[model samples]
Target: MTPQDAQAFLDENFAPWVRALDLTFTDLGQGTATATMPITDQTTRMGDILSGQALAAMADTIMVFACFAHYGEVKPVATTNLDTVFLRPGVGTHIRCEAEVVRAGKALLFTKATMFAEPSGKAVATATATFYLA
Candidate 1:
């Protein structure tokens, strides 16, 4: 999808609260998606590092988008399980996340994501997620 279409999807489909993260879809394609989440003071923890919560949220959101790309449309999908590992403290103006689907089944979809602090290119977080696709 084009950037405008991706942005419009984010504007229309996501919850107002999820939209609060201000995620921007940078690249969208079948089985793969990339997004950037701007990091302001509100997104940081005590050390000014990106909050784990934000990273997880971004991972979850991007995986959904990855599914959209995979199927060429957004289906009614819900996150069933999500796990994230912190690799390092995030240090950057934004967090870039890339997600890809490992498997897509009749009732389930599996996706994994890697998050990095841009400009620094340091890996900060990784996530695996399961979604129930209706």
Candidate 2:
């Protein structure tokens, strides 16, 4: 799917809480998708760092669109497993996530995402997810 289509899908399909992040889809390539989320009160923790939950949610959301980009269309896919590792505190005005489909099987798809703190451009978190194609 194009980035426009992916953005529309995000706007229409996500929950109100998820939409509150105000994620913007920047690019959509073969088997890959990239998005950015600004750090705000809704996404910051006590230390004023970007929350892990917010990063994980963005990773999960973008990975699903990466699956759609891989398949060339939107389809039913459920996250069977999502593993996120926090590398460092995200100390920036915004965070960017790049997700790619690692493998696509008939019944399952594997994807990975790397989230970086903008300006500093440091890796803050990484996530690998498995989705069940329905």
Candidate 3:
């Protein structure tokens, strides 16, 4: 999928909270998606560090979009399981998310994502998720 396609997918399919993150679609190709969430006070938990919840949600959303990219269309999918690990605090202008599909079967899709704090280029979080496709 092209970046424009990815942006349209996000605009059409994501939830309000996901939209509040103000994620910008950067790249979309080869069953993968890259997006950026600009850091703001609203996105931080405390002490000017990005919230883990936001990171997790962003990762999950990216995976959903990645599935759309691969399928060449939008589809209904529910998160069956989501596992996330917070590696470090993010303090930068923005957070970058890279999501890739590990596998996609008839009933389920598996994906993973890594979130990084730009400028510093530190990995802030990682996530793996299972989505039940309908």
Model 3 lDDT tens row, 31-86: 78899999999999869999888898899989888888778777888899999999
What TM-score would candidate 1 get against the native?
Answer: 0.96
At residue 24, give the lDDT of candidate 1: 90
What is the per-residue lDDT of model 2 for residues 85-119, given as tens digits with 9 covering 90 to 100?
A: 99999988899999999999999999999999998
Which structure among the candidates has the greatest lDDT?
Answer: 2
TM-score of each: 0.96, 0.98, 0.94
User: By summed lDDT, which 10 consecutive residues of candidate 2 come out lowest?
Assistant: 1-10
Pairs that collide in candidate 3 are none
User: Which residue window of length 10 is worst by lDDT in model 1?
Assistant: 1-10
Model 2, runs deviating above 4 Å: none
Which structure is stronger by TM-score: 1 or 3? 1
| Residue-level lDDT tens digits of model 1 in 1-134 | 66567789899978887899999988988888999999888888998888889899999999988988888876788999999999999888899999999999999999999999988988899999999996
Residue runs of model 3 more than 4 Å from their true location after superposition: none
